[model samples]
Target: MPKVKRALAVEDLTKIAMYSDPQIAPNEDTYAFVSATVNDDNEYQSQLFLQKINGGEPKQWTFTNAKNSHPRFSPDGKKLVFQSTRSGLSQLWIVPTNGGEAQQLTFFKNGAVNPEWSKDGKYLVFTASLKENDDVGNQHEQTKEERQKEKEQQAKEPIVIDRLKHKSDAHGFHDDKRAQLVLYDVEKATFTQLTVNDTDHGFEDISPDGNLILFSANLDDDADYALTNDLFMLNLATKDVTKLTDGNGSYGNARFSPSGDKIACFGHEYAYSGATLNELYVFDVATKERTCLSSKVDMQLGDVMVGDSRMGYSTEGPVWSLAEDKLFFIGSDHGTTGLYQADLKGNIEVLYKDNNHVFGFSYNGVDNTFILGISTPTNPCNFYQWKNTELTQLTNANAELLEEVSLSEPETITITAEDGSEIQGWLLHPYDFKEDKKYPFVLEIHGGPHAMYGQTFFHELQLLAAKGYVVLYTNPRGSHGYGQEFVNACRENYGNGDYTDLMSAVDYALENYDFIDNDRLGVTGGSYGGFMTNWIVGHTNRFKAAVTQRSICNWLSFYGVSDIGYFFTEWELGKNLLDDPAKLWDFSPLKYAENVETPLLIVHGEQDLRCPIEQGEQLFITLKHLKKEVAFVRFPGANHELSRSGNPEMRIARLNHICGWFEKYL
Candidate 1:
């Protein structure tokens, strides 16, 4: 008899392993990547794994129950350097490629991260935080007692805010420290400060000759308000700095060509505000003239697919070929992020693309081999080696767990809008789906109104489907993966076009699928999706229940509270709080609170600075005053990324609350 399969549970999130950051060795025979899994203690542990290109089970490199990511191989491929939090805070650690215990490289008090090896393998460049008055040479490791005292002192002190962008959803409030580049001599074990400035500098790459370091930052006086990153080259011997790109545009993730004659990067002018698609550019080192190589291509560069299971940062590069005649990068188009190649004359060609999400990759330009990190709707993540137009699986990190659980397969669909436009979406049937039975339906809206919903694993969506609810998610207007015009369509008209697109998708589903019960309809989303959920409930009672999370309800208050609210309002809505408060109020979901009759659940993170808890509080209070059917759930110490990377227990609880609410109402 065949073994029975069980539906995915909330605790299955702990069992799923996520893979990212693939780095191929110089010899092109082996590669290293990160595999992250939630522990029994409800914390995430990421460790490095190595495997050969031919085929074999992956060997674990690090044993620390902490984050070990951003692995970079040495020039000779004998050693690997990565960032780890094993020493209480994030620091750089180096380990041999074959075998040996890892050694700690940096002991800076403020922590060191994002280590990169120079082509010569004599120097390692990394980013470390330092106060304005602190010297790079004076950095020392603080003891446990000293750290406790500093924490106590910080609590007693008052937080003084003066900058427009004072707080971040990741690091909380601002401090006196700013990120700066530090160069370390591997043989001598000495450190040198490369650049010192009040503003933070992002480390990019070290030139092939090791005479210059490339970085990106805005050094203007109004950097606090400007949303631009300018590329800069610093001479190692003279300490002289040279600016590359014009200050009008933003650019980063630049890399020097093999011959060091040119540079490739991804950037664009804010033509369509924050919704502008990124374009590929190549700069001539001799004259500093920049050419847009991907101007003819209509796709957005990099992996813009939005999913909950993918964790950690990976390179989505404008990687240069060995001949320096071509470049490879990832592009998002038609709801799929695929690899593409471009040349100096603006010619493009598809490399490897399918319905799967290629989130991270590392290429060996010499052999034309690639180690790619891919994720699908049923699989959390796995590593594959691609060569000669063939793919060989390297690591199946979640095979044992996935074999015991039942997962839903998403069916691709396109919805036609009223304006004769096409919107892309996906529908997932219940895990225990039966064709003869009618099932409750749930519509999931992704945040970032600029982010795309694609072929990646999402734990929360799977849980809902496993609980016997048909799930539908779409990339409406204002979402990426579409053309520039489609992405910018909902910029100034948030609720007008985007709202109808979502409703039209729902209508299309009901008209096409016969197993969905229209009466047991539910809706939920976060961020912009959260705002839309609130708008839908206030405008129509079609949804039997709704859950709005980390959402924006009042533009007037959000403008002053959210970290990006000051500029995002004007960028997305074409109006600032100072320029036009009335219009901002008119577009707010709180304005239509009186019409909401459906049962609503308001969920938010207390520490979220993106949407802020006040946005949810005001909506809840207003609905309560009107005697509406509503409930509020607040997550303590959680930020905007609670759903994606929050505490494991909190994540499980959040899923339970959402599924429990739908089960109770629908």
Candidate 2:
């Protein structure tokens, strides 16, 4: 028998994101999207490409050597505005929609993002951060008298700095400063500051009439609290500010109706334990009464807006209809994210259903047409459009690159747990399947414990399948897409019940899929999945090898180390370390490390603020002390998102280490 070419070595995994932001032209006739391609130096460089909906060769738009993203079309559809770091810093740039030399719009030392055109198309609004008075550059230029006062203050005491990660999870690490809103006049080439404060104000939406700007911020309050984000409206003419939403909950991404009579926004009601579930809410500007539009949906709504003068909703990003009457959005329940359309009366209809993920929808108000971006477990993101109930593929972003690689299609399976609870999972067979032959298998777990592994594209899973392993992944208890009760099932139970569900999934794969080799089974996961990987190795030794990425080995240390440590531990474990140290340690994977005999590969990002590197360090140290087989691989300059959205090179390297470890041991 011919040996399966060691499924492309880990080093050969593409080191570039297959797709980026996909934006539809205002007219909806064509679309422009950014694609990151790996260059000769292995650096993933981003470039913009344009394609028509009916089908045609995608035309390359930008030829710069820098990264470009968040492409938006002007109201007239003649100009394209986007954010780029071509000038050493991220700034706004404008070019003709038909392609031309781009012009720089903002020249501030600080960067700008989220550029939106005014209704009249004469101005643009964006967000930026300016330096404060105490900054080194500002202090260096102070007058001699002012410098002497500063010197005297410095002599009084030593300066003490206290901070965890210098950057944030939302915007990565950078200089300490505050973000503010600014507007630029397109015709005059002038800029005007719209907001002035020390607090951060983001999630901006300008009214269709351009009379009021809506946003969310926690000014003069506890900025660190997640529940403090409230919607605020700024009158552009009088510079008057009004608080639209109040109370201890988050209200953001406010969008005004075409007539400016109603506002659509996403609200998150924070529970006592700090777990937030996003729901859609609409406020009648005249009555000042808020109505819950998506309370029955039981999932977060994103990208909400007034489309075609009708209320439309999306989760995290908006998908307005071409005629502006229908709004399309992605809603997830039971781990499946699908596209749906809703009207002003809160009536919703499913537009498309698939086991994959769908997002980034653009509507052409003129033609009543729309384009959407979709991807599946075995497919990378590609542009698709719905016409006459038929989905048409527009751009094959990674077809050529992935053509040489063989990918496996996941088989959906349902399994019964020890307690008779039914769970859902996917089994991806080896690329070359043979009857009566059993192949090694790997059980993969998703993080979030709250997050789910859906029919979405997972690069790591594909690599394992290519290496002759039947990969099994599941949406166990506590995973989203199931109802709220099912999602919160693992709260306080943690490693016990969830572990049983995963082990049950493994059993189902072995029994049902005759091709799965029971003795060569291995397991892996990250974040919460990482925690389970550790927990699994401790409780059982059925697998020959295991890989844990960004895992939590000690709940005690996690209570203080993570950014959301205090609240997360309290919510998941039912108590903080301070409240019940013994309880926190009782569920910790480190406590059961003595039973771990499976060869383990531990991976972590050096800069992860969620699980942090210490979590991996503790596990590796414990396993080494116990004389158990283990190896540690750390990715430099990567955060918790290293596996998902980290640098492409680093992501490939991380995947390679996992494949290498499994190949050697399993």
Candidate 3:
């Protein structure tokens, strides 16, 4: 007898635990990671867990039940320091490696995050929000009642906007402030302010000798109007700051090699504008000379592969070899992200290759073991240990929840685009698929027209398939994981080439698969994908329904309202509204609103700053005014990340809205 499994339900989203941020111990024997689950209060609760390489049950270290992250091992590996929000604000806390009561380290009013250990483990450097003026420290010197009154007064005060980039999508309406570095002496229990510049000073990594701290900040006089972040180091002993890279481009992820003679980083000149791939570089700290290592490798240095998860993931670390000759990093290639090795002589090779997507990773040279966070179409992102070319799973946080639900494994599909470009995609059959019966189809597009949809688990797709829809998603012209030239293809020629690629996928599916009903087709996407969804319906009425989330409608208004609008518009569209008004209007979906015949469900977060709520509002209002079939769904107190890592309730509601809209129209 065969056992039947239950199809995945939308409510199962909250039951699954998302794992990320795995930090290996200094000796590579033990590792600490974070796991997030929705608790009874409907708020996402993240806790730190410790695991050994040998194999055993993973132990929960932090019972705070709030957000706890960035688990780091001290030099001696005797203690672990992490950031926690147990005291109502995120602050640094330490716990003994063996086991003991968690000890509080900092009480800064604005809170602290991203704790970095010095080579000797004597000092800890971190970043905190600060007032732009810098006349007073960030600590809250006022009492509780006084603070309440201040908040009350501000609620009734008039709104003000002065800075060109005062608001960010991650951060809410904070005063025009920058994040600055602060030093904490673990033994002495004292705090020292490191930099007092008006610009943001973010900590990167400490030198091997522990005498200097490397950071990146835009110190240009007109920083607000320009995009520049140069690498700099502050001498702890002499309190001096020195610049390392020229202002030719933006540089970040600076790390000191084992020998401390050179710094390996990931960045590049905006040669191709925003569509440019991040290139790897080696800088001589002593000579101030730089060399781009991955110039020959056209792939992006880190993972930008897109997936649907409550906890986000990306390939971001750049670790050095024991001999400081070769560097290990992650690269997006052919719809999958994998480990790659680079040398000082401008050589690179793949150390690990697989069809799965690598989200987060860490390497420990002491034991020669690697910790990889990866995901597949059926498997969620989890930690795996690699030793001597052998692999083992470390944590299966979602295994229990997944045992009760059924999921479809996506089949990889490849097709040649109109321009001879290879387009990679995936197709998921209905859970109860029958070859004799026809099924409705939905095309899912990813955000970041630069992001790739690869071998990863997407809950929304699973639900759509369970409801008898054939789900098809692809890596179009502008998607990452393909080479640099392919990623930049959809930049200036938005609906021309990329639109053809998407339409070609639909045509390929209709020709190859006999189960699809061409008349009952749908489309949905967020961000750039959202923009494409609107464009798809306006250009052709092939889709019966469409959903655009956190979308952009008009480039003229987007150039001013979006946090990075003014520059992103020029970077993506290749022209600002001021330089080419007619072209901007020509590409805007708002200009073609009268051509839309498909029913649309506009979804957006009220607090989204990247594509402000007004973008969705304008589209919905225009369609309604024209007596078209349209509806709008807004999530309050949510941002652009509402679908990914936003509040659990809101995320579930959003998934429901997506499915309901498709059910009603398709």
Q: Which candidate leads the pack in TM-score?
A: 1
Writing each residue's lDDT as its tens digit, candidate 1 over 1-666 gives 987889999999888888888888888888888888887678999999888878778888888888889999999998999999998789999988878899999999989999999999999999999886666666787877888999999999999988887898988998888999999999999888887888999998889999889999999889998999999999999999999988888898799999888989999889998999899999888899989998787888999998889888877999998989999898888877778889889999988998888898898888887887888899988888778888888887888888899999899999999898999999999987889999999999999899999898998888899999999999999999888998899998988999999999999999999999999999999999999999999889999999999999999999899999988999999999999899999899999999999999999999999999999999999999999999999999999999999998888888889998999999
Q: Choose the strongest candidate by lDDT.
A: 1
Query: Which tens-of-lDDT digit does each residue in 1-666 have in candidate 3?
Result: 656778888888888777888788886778888888889999988889888878888899988668888898999999999988887778889989988998888777667889989999999999977775543233653455765888899899976977786778988665756788988888887778888888888788999899989999999888878787899989989998889977878898889998788998988888888888898988898898988898778798887878777373323667898888888888888788888888888899987778887778888887666898888878777889877777788877688767777788888898788888779899999987899999999999999888888877788888899888999999999998878889899888888899999999999999999999988999999999999999999999999999998999998899999988989988989889799999999889999999999999999999999999999999999999999999999999999999888888998899899999999988
How would you order the candidates by TM-score, starting with the best? 1, 3, 2
**Model 1 ranges off by over 4 Å:** none
lDDT: the better of candidates 1 and 3 = 1
List the pairs of residues colliding in candidate 3: none
Model 3: weakest 10-residue lDDT segment is: 134-143
**10 residues in a row with least lDDT, candidate 2:** 304-313
The C-alpha lDDT values of all candidates are 0.91, 0.74, 0.86
For TM-score, candidate 1 versus 2, the one ahead is 1
lDDT, candidate 3, at 634: 96
What is the lDDT, from 0 to 100, of the residue 145 in candidate 3?
A: 75
Off by over 4 Å in 2: 1-12, 15-17, 133-175, 272-276, 300-326
Q: Sorted on lDDT, highest at the top, how do the candidates line up? A: 1, 3, 2
Residue 283 of model 3: what lDDT?
88
Question: Which residue pairs does candidate 1 place in steric collision?
Answer: none
For every model shown, what is its TM-score relative to the native structure?
0.99, 0.90, 0.97
